[model samples]
Target: MTSVYPYLPEMIASFGVERKDVAKWAGATSAVFSVAQSLTAVPWGRASDKFGRKPIIMTGLFCTMCFFLAWGVSTSLKMAIIIRALQGACNGNVGIIRTMVAEMVQERELQPKAFSIMPLVWSVGSVFGPAFGGLFAKPAERFPGLFGNSYFFNKYPFALPNIIGGVVFLISLSTAMLFLKETLHSKRHSRDWGLILGRRITEAFKDRPFRRQQKLRRYSIQDAEASAPLLQTDGTSRPAKAGREKPVAPSMSSVFTRQTVISLVSYTFLALHSVAFDQVLPVFLNYPPQEHTPRNTSLPFFFSGGFGLNSGHIGTIFTFYGITSGVIQFVLFPPLCARFGVLRCFRVCVLVFPVIYFLLPFTVLVENATTRYAALLVLMICKAFAVIIGFPCSTILLTNSAASLSILGTLNGFATTFSALGRASGPALAGLAFTWGVKNNMIGAPWWILGFIAAVGSLPVWMIVEGEGPTAGSSDSSDAESTDAEEEAVVFDDDDDLLDNLTTARRGSGREQQGLLKKGSEDTRNTGYGTVR
Candidate 1:
């Protein structure tokens, strides 16, 4: 998707759209893709819960690869829209990825670093994607000596970027196919062809006898675990090893608690405006530069102009931002989150977005190229810094709000639907806002609108109650009048359909490791989320 950004206007115009309406066409394609994602994200999440994370992830990657190939060759706007939609339909993997991270890293303290991995991965793609799009689009014209007489290059002006994107997707898909494991507990222990094949391939690289021995040893371990006897809790003489937990149907009624709703609301609004910002920034940069004679306009409210940069320069700018973002994620965000705490860090991140949007139009006024670049660097660095803090912190809170570890995938999936809806609406609204500003000579109109949205998004942050969760087994609660009869009913593991009847304990509690280790254990008592192994 980032690969398409640099050449999106050119791509749309090649299909007969007028220069004035290219933003509209671009928005249409982007909107269609997001709408498709919105429709499928929840279903895909549910499928990950029911089937397994690895399968859905592989399927998404495969679909994305196909979409890239198809989109590369699209001859008309209609074809572009269709292919983009298909691309969106397969991209419900983000939530599943988050779910896996939450499951894999159980400690609350480690969550900021863990969740930051996805955004960092995206930053890597953003850096390369824009570079590819800018440098490679319309190769026939850019490098006529090499591609001038090639019919393929002439007919498919935008093919190079998509081809590169396809190759990247293929690499990711291959990696997932060979090594990715199923994170869903219930679906785990089932045969994983990827891991098995991965082992076989690795062993094949060794000497023959070494390979055979490794395979034999591997099989012995797996077979012993598979054949392990179930532990008896009845105090019988039979001493047995731990065995697979019986599968239980996950219940969803309790998933959407008050905290969950609050988190989703903030997440949705954040998605809405941030996506709009991304859509409009390049278009704003690509707009015509203002002349020496200034128009009769008020400061901030009435303005008409842009950075007037070409695709290559614009892509380089975005690539710079991507690198800066990765740096901030690695060096800044985690430390700040750790020192100040996730909620405080999140609130500070949320509060600054409106200011960022408000300042964007001012960058257009600078005449000196160096000054303008400096301004952009500052604005984008701030934006990246905030984003790096916001997304991971938000995800951690979202996971905290989940009623059961089992429902993390479902909760993330369910929430992704709304975020996808926000993304769906963002491009179209931004296009309209940009168009309106162009006609009205108030180039800052879209910025103001987005600023308002960011302000609105900040509202729910205050309402959110951030903690590890509703901590279970805390002795500090004031319930002086309560007796044994008034105590919360004990829930046995066998009795809980969600497989998690109680909440996770306070962060840093000793029970955190216990709850994580005992996951999916059949004989595990109905203990609070804090105690397990």
Candidate 2:
């Protein structure tokens, strides 16, 4: 996205729009994409629950391919907007993929490790995508020695990046088709072949015979009776009562407890703040230092307050950020999570956002280029750390908050929908805010606004109550207490049953009963406790 930021003015100008409206159109275009994504994220998540994770993911990949192709060939800003929106509508895979990862790792303790893959993978892609866009975009124009006078290159100067992006998506789709596993329990038992062709052929061969032989098994009361070996009954006394009843688990409705609600709200706010920051940063960085006088040309440049970087420069910076982000996600995050625990780690990360935002504008104050770059790099690292930390932790907490395993899909879907809302609003608002700040000659205004948002967003994190321990999600407190009480009561109940059976045996034999009674009385006197007697 940063790669394309440098070209937005050019892209907009080709549509014959006024220069002043570029920011507005940029924000609008991004909003359209988010709006589409917001509308479909929940539905896709629901579909993943009903169908399976792999299929949903593959569908998203296919949509991404289409999106890139169309975006590359776009003749006008309107086409780009529609294509982007289409892509968003079709590619609602974020939550579904999160669900897949959570389900993939059964052991609760290993989940953090598994979840760390997501951010790392995303960072890697972020690095590559912008690099591709920055270096490959407008290839016909930029690389005339290679693509000069070629019909394809001449007709679609900016199509090279899109073509590469599409191919990448295709490769990803192929990989998914071959290696991705179905994590949904219901879909798991249905034969999976690890590769598309093998699965198809296997299903084709199995379908006829499988259906022909399929028959429902019926339950039998006789089977139940045969399985239960009878306990002896004493005629001298009544039959022993049953053991204590087992504890019932909490209902699905119990998932919406105060802690869970607070976590969700906090997560949504975090998303809003994080995404807004991300959207604003690139624009701020690419913008030239503030200009005192109007220029003859309408090309984009940083004003006095901006970084004044080209697309390639911006891409290089993002590449650096991405590499560092990957390291932090994979190497640093797990230990941090282990050392500080997920909630504390998340809270600390949240607190860092405001600090990062506040410090970001200060980079412009540095007079030396090298010093400014160094300072900016450090700030970017901190920002990446802040951004990456909250997501995985929030995902863990969300999974933990599930009322039942069955409802994980629904809960994540709801989370994705809320997140989509934030994503949709953030970029648009950020663009507008930056534009407003620049036009009003208050360059720090956007930063200040963002800082406030981050600070306010952090407040909700305090309300999230961490679970007791690793086994916290297994059951609730009331159920645990009930289970303990039931277990304690079972010993007496078993003794009563055994005593009744002994009494029945005594009743059957009169001489034996008298002898046994005498022995029992002697034993009871000696032990001063009930036993076989």
Question: In lDDT terms, which candidate is top?
Answer: 1
Which candidate number maximizes TM-score? 1
Please give the lDDT score for candidate 1.
0.74
Superposition error at 531 for model 1 (Å) = 23
| TM-scores, one per candidate | 0.83, 0.74
Candidate no. 2 TM-score: 0.74
Candidate 2: C-alpha lDDT = 0.66
Report clashes for each candidate as comma-separated counts.
1, 11
Least lDDT summed over 10 consecutive residues: which range in candidate 2? 217-226
lDDT of 2 at 136: 73
Residue 432 C-alpha lDDT in model 1: 82
Any runs in candidate 2 off by more than 4 Å, and if so which? Answer: 1-10, 13-20, 193-256, 291-304, 468-533
- Model 2 C-alpha lDDT per residue in residues 1-533, reported as the tens digit of each score: 32234445445556777644555567667677767877888788778777777888898888778876877778887788898888778766678887777665646567778888888888897788777766776777778899877888677666787788788888888888765667664454343444445344444566665643321111101111111122222112122222211223234366466666787787887887787776567667767765344442121323336787766777778778888989899889988888888889899989998898777776776778899899999988998998788889988887776655555666677677777777777667777777776776555556667788889988988887765322345333345346435433211122234345446657866887767655544433442212232
